[model samples]
Target: MNLAVTAAAAAGAPLLSGDKGTTSEAAVGETLVSRLGDAMLGLGSRLPDMRPETLGWELSHALTDFHTCQYTSLAVRLPRLLQAGHALTSSSDSPEPALLLAQSYTLATRMLIKLDEQQLGWMAADRARQLATAANDPLAVAEAARNLAVLGRKAHWHDAALSVALDAADDPALRTAGRRGAAQRGLLIQCAAYTAARNGDRDGMRDLTAEAASIADALGGTTLLRDHGGGFGPVTVQLHLISAENSVGDPAAALAAARALSPKALPSQERRSRYYTDVATALAHRGRRDECVRALLTAEQAAPEETHARPAVKSLISGLLVSGRTTSELRGLAARSGLLT
Candidate 1:
């Protein structure tokens, strides 16, 4: 994981500044991308040694950083490099460095889906799948499929996500001992839980979430590096618990669990926004309108570009806007917060 993180950090460094077509710049970028690939391979080999807790934190932070860097790179750096790579390389043989680039793109797609960046996520996912397939690696394939599931969940394509996760779960190569086979089961359960939650299937959600939590606990000492798609980690499991508690109308417990998770420590704005949104929803359910509004404000502040436009946030805000006790205050806050454009 540290190697992957280091590679990610290094790969994200600015390319040598000059003409994009220059031989010198193209060589430099190729070298950097190759190094990044070597680092990812090294990290992959060490994943079996990682504990689940450490893996969770590593994956969470690494994926988060990976996404952020991709967003920046795609918007600025990728196109130039792609053109340069095409001009500089004529061989059809897939390079080891290409795998790292593909994985990074896959991770970026996952993050975009999490942040509701639908179109971009789809594009990135497609490229990742092609690259992973070319690499002929089962782990990479499973990872790409998992990213697709993230997109499916975000787009409300529950059936699609379920199908993909189930397929990944059935892959024999991904069920190795060091990979923690149960973790794959947990991913399937999470997909089921999300589908159940969307359909208001209380019993289904409860049963599936419980099963997922159990698997997560069973793999408690593992790191996320080995099975990136496995759906167990402290922060992620806690997040599932919070969602379940809220869905079951247990606001007090939901709030308590959310608070206990220390949302403030999350480095990604996307994650922070999600935590705050849950807190706001729970507070609102308890009729703590002021507190709810404040939490909502924090969420919006954390990721202003997307939070204000999110369906759930909009729905919650609409509810608060009609509440006589808080409508005026909310309007004032919206204006001051620059959220009411």
Candidate 2:
């Protein structure tokens, strides 16, 4: 398992330029996400080859596609990756195969959640958790826990989500895993903070966010474990704070937090897109109509597939069109998102 090589390759893949794609590009991407959802849920009949020889490399490229927000590519690749991962894990006694399988499922869970496929998302997340526990890797288990917590939040089980995150953060093994442990724990805490905000516990949100920030500060400003998901560090913490503030109905505070972080400091296109989208959300909530549109446009420019294919983002675009005098750019964004065509 040459994880270093895998990480380097994934990191070096080129970012898809969001400004260059046409409406057909987004349409194709949306189709891919839909197809993948069907395939994962056994609605698709064709199965990928069971050959697991390239499992490691396949997982790396799939992860690169994921972080780059190249959903079309990822959607095309993941069915095969998941198929091969399952085959290998079932046949082999090695923990390494199980860990890889868990990671692969975790990626699928994250993508399904983004596409608003909650039913399949929950299934993938649970599978990842079971495999992670089987592999006996604390970091992998913590990541699975974070995904499950996210699904719980989406299901509106706010208290359960908070508990999942807090328990993962408190794991004795995770607490002892050193820098990697700290990074994972910080992410779990960040999750708990957002769950708190969703449940309307504003003070708890702030306190937990602060606690996560302290962990990031102790990491000395370096982002870590990006290949597993979005990296964790100070910038990521601030990004979460923006969304948390918005969730708690403080759009003004959300915008303030947004202003404090430089988008270029974010580790991946996924995080960068999230930063701009959060800014857009805050602007919209504050009734800054034009500014909100501009922020969303910036998010699309950062990662077109992420912005275009996101259900929440499309809803935001639809809301803008419903209430205001539509600008040319806003209309174009709607067309690209398949809402206007």
Candidate 3:
């Protein structure tokens, strides 16, 4: 995934503008925490009552901001979404508000994780799971499980991540036939593939990604999802495969997989930037210094604020500097990205 920054960036750098949308990861976390805290402290009355339809519309926009890595906008909107969601979930007897609340919490979990706040992200993930379970919606439950698995993986709990991903995928609730089922099943395997990579289970990564690929092919290029918000479909599967290969230290295979896909085909700027970053990582590992720099530059263009905030990108820059080219161009790139700091 790709990201921007908030007023409070994860890595102690202020956000820089990109040609594409970019925002602050720091602000995203701080804002969510503060806003949620206020709501919990009985500030709910300060916010206007929102209908389910209005809340849903705002949620869609917030999700669009999320997919595009617009964290500054998210910082403004997400807190309000949470408040409105809480209000709706409490006032309305309908299950829609509850499901919407779960989805909003899941979105919060994603944002917090990206900002490297895993412990705090846990709250959002668990809240999502609780709401989803209470709603008894299979799709909501599946999405919540996926978010929980992501939080687990981020926290380096590989075994637990893999178990939850597989269990969520195999839950009878997800066994129904057709497109949604296929998407959920494919997504779980992708998460499992990610866990396998983190656990250094190379063969499992390969097998799980292959299964996901087969499911994608079965969908006949239908693109089961049109946005990263859904987090499924053929494009995401390819991205996950590349990430798994890279995580397993197979840079050559990672680059090969990256080359097989087109960034333009990705639905959001965040994923496109992530594709470039993955390519940069693979190139860096191969000592293809010039190409690595080029790929990172491409990533920055896609999302400058995000590129700097990523741990992997920071590590790659440090590695490149250690290898000691020391050219003016390289130095300039490093300075602009705040890698020199």
Candidate 4:
């Protein structure tokens, strides 16, 4: 996905530059977010054929790529979209474009939630709220609130996250699609559980997760939030399991789950690198220093220029250096891999 971002740069220029005024800018921003969302969904649709481990690796890397790029794009595009929507709202003009603009802002808000940027994500959510209100679309408003809930989870704003989730779960517009609404509620419950776990409320986490799992079962095992407007599947549950395991300091369990989801042979270079890097971390946590080094070597070989600079990879190196048991060997390996050179 990071490489895709680089490839998308040239194509994105025309989309970025064609915005002549506030309204045009908002329109374009909406198109861009929608397009990106569609692209992600398309990628996900192809996942069934790939190995679970490989699919997991790709998802992880794509999310990392999203984290890297969403901030810059939001900063450049969001204000213009908001201003344009506001202008249309204040005027007694036709609300069609305003409604469309609101939907666009909502899409952007969803994208921002995925990026792990708290403040900017909240700002985008606020814009989405205002646009939805102006457009008189209760469904859009509910969806925006749900997105805020997700952002709050990422930011560790527990009370705010729970409130937003509850509000979304109760929104009447959510009933438009019965199974989807239930699935969305289930995912929100999972998010709340995750937040509870982070706060060290074990009972709270367990209770919430249990309820979410029950709802997911009732919803036929779809766990992804419907507000995101994509098909939710088992991967959602697997990711939640991974998070739960990690929160409990069960690196072995986390690794087992991750390994079960990753592909045997990564379909993309980016995915191959990420998979090996994760394998390194899991091995390191398990005290398998030599195996960890081997995984790191593979990651470095896969994407020599970019993978070595990854924060996770760097952190792993630092941890190993401080451990005192494998510093010399790791240093030698790093030199050979050109990571230290």
Candidate 5:
């Protein structure tokens, strides 16, 4: 689960494209989304011979694929990963298997949230929490709680989302897990900050965000558990601030925050893509259409599959198409994103 390695690989990874007899990126995204929806409902078939170690190996690969934002390949891998994870939990008595299974579900929940599949996301998050709690893995349980809070915010359960995040951040086990625990707590508080912004508590967002930043400062430059927290640290905290500022209708602040850090300095392509997309959103809000397109182009370059597949990106493209002066570059980008078709 060395996400740093995956992040480095992602820098040079080729984007998925359509080829003769090959699955289109669009089709892969759709199929994976559908299958994940099915899996959340316990309707998917299981794979046999899913030993605990095998599940661990597959889970590691799955997390790597996610960190790299290799969604096309991830789509191909997740079905078997989910099925095998499910199969192992039924056959194994060890808590390790359940913890692995919980992580698998957490990964699925992350993907579902990214794809805006909130209905299925809830189920996956709940399953992750249940399995993590059953395994008595406090760290995994906190991670599961983060996903649940994210899904809660998506569903507009603002107060509940904030509570979920704050409670997990306050967990005694996580409080003592050292730097890893600190990073995890920072992540949960980061989520709470965003939820606060969404709920229109601008001051609360800043206060919570500052709290996370203080933790990041305490950790200094190291990115603990890059796979788990996506490099939660000072740089990552700034990235979230960009989004949180935008969420609170401070596009200028968001753009300013974006200007403070190079996306390349971020730990993962996923985070880099997030950096630019949030910038694009802020630019779009500020009516800087040209800058917005350029920001999106940068995001697409960082992780094409992730950039093109996100509904938020598609909506930004769609909005751009119907407003302002049209350009060949914008049209081409829109067509590639499947919004023009």
Candidate 6:
């Protein structure tokens, strides 16, 4: 989220073997081209050896930044790291950098989906899959599958998403009882939960959540294992429930779930913000205008950029405002959100 610090030397970036600006595959073609030029050309092999630790830290920070709704900054930063990873891979046959690159693509896939660029999201997920496969790493493949499942869900391919999640969850790599298996298992469960929600299969949603909750319980409540965007704990299971209920048009259940758990239990600012946003959406659906506005205001306080730019948030604000829900508090928020204009 730090737009002020984009210097390549400060962050470990990957080197893509291909020249810059060669393709316009991203949804916002020109915008992405411009961003990628700055993003990719600037990020070289900042570390001569490009150690996995440095890449991991840089990637983790980048992932956090993306999660916190720093899209513009990510647009200007991720390409550098991705291309830098490619450069490392081409220069040497090391799997570490490639694995990191796959992770980067996974983050990119998620971010683009949030940005509502599912076409580009699919491309990013595909790249992640290719890299993960080449690396021949089980965790990486699971991560790739997770990304693909999300992209499929967003694209309204609910059945495909469910298939991907189930396949990844059943993978021998993720079946074992260990740190990696636990993380991947938790991630796959959430993936299946959301996809089931999209399909409006209430039982499927609950079943998947129960499965994930068991993993969280076995892991002793909340453990932040740096895999699949850090949502594998008890708190995350609850958040997933809120999201699932919301997706399936169960506003009452979504609100109930949101109210039952403390946002304090959520691991990151991003998740906290999203929880409030979902609450706002459910409130809006339930015709509780004032509460909806209040929840959105709380979400904005958690992460202003995220709340402002999120499609669901924007849509909810616009809908309430357009419908003439004119409480003073709601109008104030509407003005700030540019909904009144």
Model 6 agreement with the true structure over 90-133: per-residue lDDT tens digits:
77677887788888888777666665667667777788888888
Q: Better model by TM-score, 1 or 3?
A: 3
Off by over 4 Å in 2: 1-23, 28-30, 38-53
Error of 6 at 247 (Å): 2.4
**Weakest lDDT window of 10 consecutive positions for candidate 5:** 1-10
Please write out the lDDT profile of model 1 over residues 61-166, one tens digit for every residue: 4555342332332322333333323222223364433454455566656545543457767776776777777766666666677777767866778777767877
Per-residue alpha-carbon lDDT of candidate 3 for residues 1-341, written as tens digits (9 for 90 to 100) = 11211212233323322223344442334444555555434564457889999998988988988777766676667777888888889998888898888888888777777766676678888888899888887777787788789888887899999899989989887787457777887888899999999889999998999898898888766344322354576788888888888889898999889988889988777888889988887887787888888888898888765665555566666667767576666666666655553
Q: Which of the two candidates, 1 or 6, achieves a greater TM-score against the reference?
A: 6
What overall lDDT goes with each candidate model? 0.56, 0.80, 0.74, 0.54, 0.80, 0.71
**lDDT comparison, 1 vs 2, better candidate:** 2
For each candidate, what TM-score against the reference?
A: 0.63, 0.89, 0.85, 0.56, 0.91, 0.82
lDDT of 3 at 234: 74
Superposed by TM-score, candidate 6 places the C-alpha of residue 146 at a distance from the truth, in angstroms, of 1.2
Question: Candidates 3 and 6: which is better by TM-score?
Answer: 3
Per-residue accuracy of model 5 over 159-244 as CA lDDT, tens digit each: 99999999999999998888888889999999999999999999999999999999999888756673374758888889989999
Comparing 3 with 4 on TM-score, the higher-scoring candidate is: 3
Candidate 3 global CA lDDT score: 0.74
Locate the minimum summed-lDDT window of 10 residues in model 3.
1-10
Give the alpha carbon lDDT tens digit for every residue of 1-341 in model 4. 01001101111223343224222221333334443444323321211133324323433333343333332343334434444444444554755555555555555565544333355557667767776777676655766776777787677787888878776766766566577666666666777777776666767777877787677666774434313433344445555655565565566876886777653433345445656666666677678877888887777666553343333455566566566466666786544423354
Candidate 4 residue pairs that clash: 52-261, 52-262, 53-261, 53-262, 53-263, 54-262, 54-263
TM-score of 1: 0.63
